[model samples]
Target: MTSYYTIDHLPGRTIQLDGQDYLFFSGTSYLGMAQHPAFQALLAEGMARYGTMFGSSRNGNLQLNIYGEAEAQLAAFARAEAALTLSSGMLAGQAVVNWLKAQGFGFIYGPKAHPAIWQDPSTSLPTVSFTDWTDQLPELVAAAATPNVVIALNSLDALCSVDYSFDWVNRLPDGQEVTLLVDDSHGFGVIGPEGSGVGALIPRRANVRLIVTASLAKAMGMPGGVIFADPETLRAIRHTAFFGACSPIPPAYLHAFGRAQALYRTAFERLQTNIARFENRIGLSDRFQHIPAYPVFYTEQDQLYSYLLANRILIYSFAYPTPADKPNTRIVISALHQPEDIEQLGDCLYGKTG
Candidate 1:
């Protein structure tokens, strides 16, 4: 069985548990926006103006203007023709999948694609490696009898600490019209130019339609999910019952997200510096598998999990998505960590004490 623990407060550079303090090195907070004082203050100001929550549907007569304003900013930032916001990233994924299902398109999923983008909840994900899957994608799509197909995948696989390329989209046979759906939940505020995510970098073509979905909660520190697509497709999706019936993301979050752009840039730079510093300290070793400029460092060294715990250092080590999956052990670097914290973590990884 996997172990579990609880903490009373939000984790930053460190976490406190059972009267003990440990250097925290887990979670998807790449930009460290959650614990940022300026960001928090912006959120507080937002709450003061918008209140805690808005329970009505977005389609209701009384609408908060912040929703449209923030979404416009998001669309501009992502370079998408249009954008839509939902209560959660899962809901955003489901809404897009549900819409695609109604259009009668066949689905092809990437190996590490999140369950959020799955067409059917009970369907199992492929057990093959990502490279293997990519190699077979063109042949697989060419063989499918369906006229329309949707290829769903993640912008990058965070659990495995691997970044993916969309060059395969160009290799697929032209017989079927393709809609590329990317779940950028992990990459939204950490990857790509200006931390805009992979939406802008994905190659565009005449016949291929692109849709990018992300949870802003990860690095953006907003309690919401966003969808980016062409204007016509976005209009159709907006009309869906899934979009109409669901509660929208808290207006306060949108309020803060719109005003904290500069703060986000600073955090991204800090996170990059921290990742570089940590990598330099650790150097190249078989003990870790990671990508340059990425924040996660994955490892199969299960013993290190316990060893770090004994030394008051914490990282992710557990069965992810389900109990049947491999224990998702990784060290997550974040912008909140300082030079001293990085040094301490490096010492712990080397089996040395303060």
Candidate 2:
């Protein structure tokens, strides 16, 4: 079939996989409440009050107080100086790249950096490709014989696992003025000990300026992406053609963020515990097959994804049309997930196949 539905032949929570309806386990829904009652309630309230789309930039007549509140909480939550709510997380990436280009900075990227970070910037930066950016980063930069570097980080990638004694952000080349941008798309609210972004987990490293951006689509279990940075930088982008020209979010999404912030801390602790449980019960200790995160164990992962789908279970998988090589399949634990769900997924992954 040219098009597909959920594995269970439903929408949202379910999507078609391998010719059968299955709970979509292959997307980033860390809190797993795409259909939560509160979400619905807020959505209805927003529809009644603010309509579906904001229809203009936040600077327009509709200075959505809800959107502003979400931005504030997001900045506070990310523990950054400030935040800007983008229509999407990916949009955040696009905006950032544009900003860097305007700054007239040359960029060098980690091997596994997200496509949005460097690939599209090919027209721009003096690029360097490395097998393992963590190991080759300094050497490659030293060899490049250039300065004015911008390092884009996707924390889940293996290149940045342990977070070291502190973080790689600090270990950046000593005399170079580095602009370290971390797209904590996967790490926000999910990996850190607190619901705070991963930036909070690691001690601030030297000359290690941070700019984090993430989609609320995943761990926030809602739609849209929020970009966090200092207020000055964010404000400067406000009038830029890219950001200033676009419509803002619907009131419904704004409401969703308020609800997410209220519940985020509790959900974080629950998911962390579940990760601990998955590791403890299976008698296995490892990181995700492709990315670096807590208790996302395994490798050679297609078999695991297939097994999960066949049993009517689901998780995020970066298989198929998205990218053929990266085994992006993932099981996102949620506050809504029961302890039993964890057991079942663990058993399926760890159980002996006779």
Q: Whose lDDT is greatest here? A: 1
Candidate 1 Cα misplacement greater than 4 A, ranges? 351-354
Q: Rate the local accuracy (lDDT) of all candidates.
A: 0.89, 0.63
- Taking every candidate in turn, the Cα RMSD to the unseen true structure, in Å, is 1.7, 4.4
User: Model 1, 51-129: lDDT tens per residue?
Assistant: 9999998888888899899999998777678899999999999999999999898998888789889999776778898
Location of the lowest summed lDDT over 10 successive residues in candidate 2: 1-10
Q: What digit string (tens of lDDT, one per residue) describes model 2 on residues 104-190? A: 766666545675566363434324434345666666555554466677766665322323223544455776666667677777877
- Compared with the true structure, the alpha-carbon lDDT of candidate 2 equals 0.63
TM-scores, all candidates, are: 0.96, 0.80
Q: Cα deviation of 133 in candidate 2 (Å)?
A: 2.0
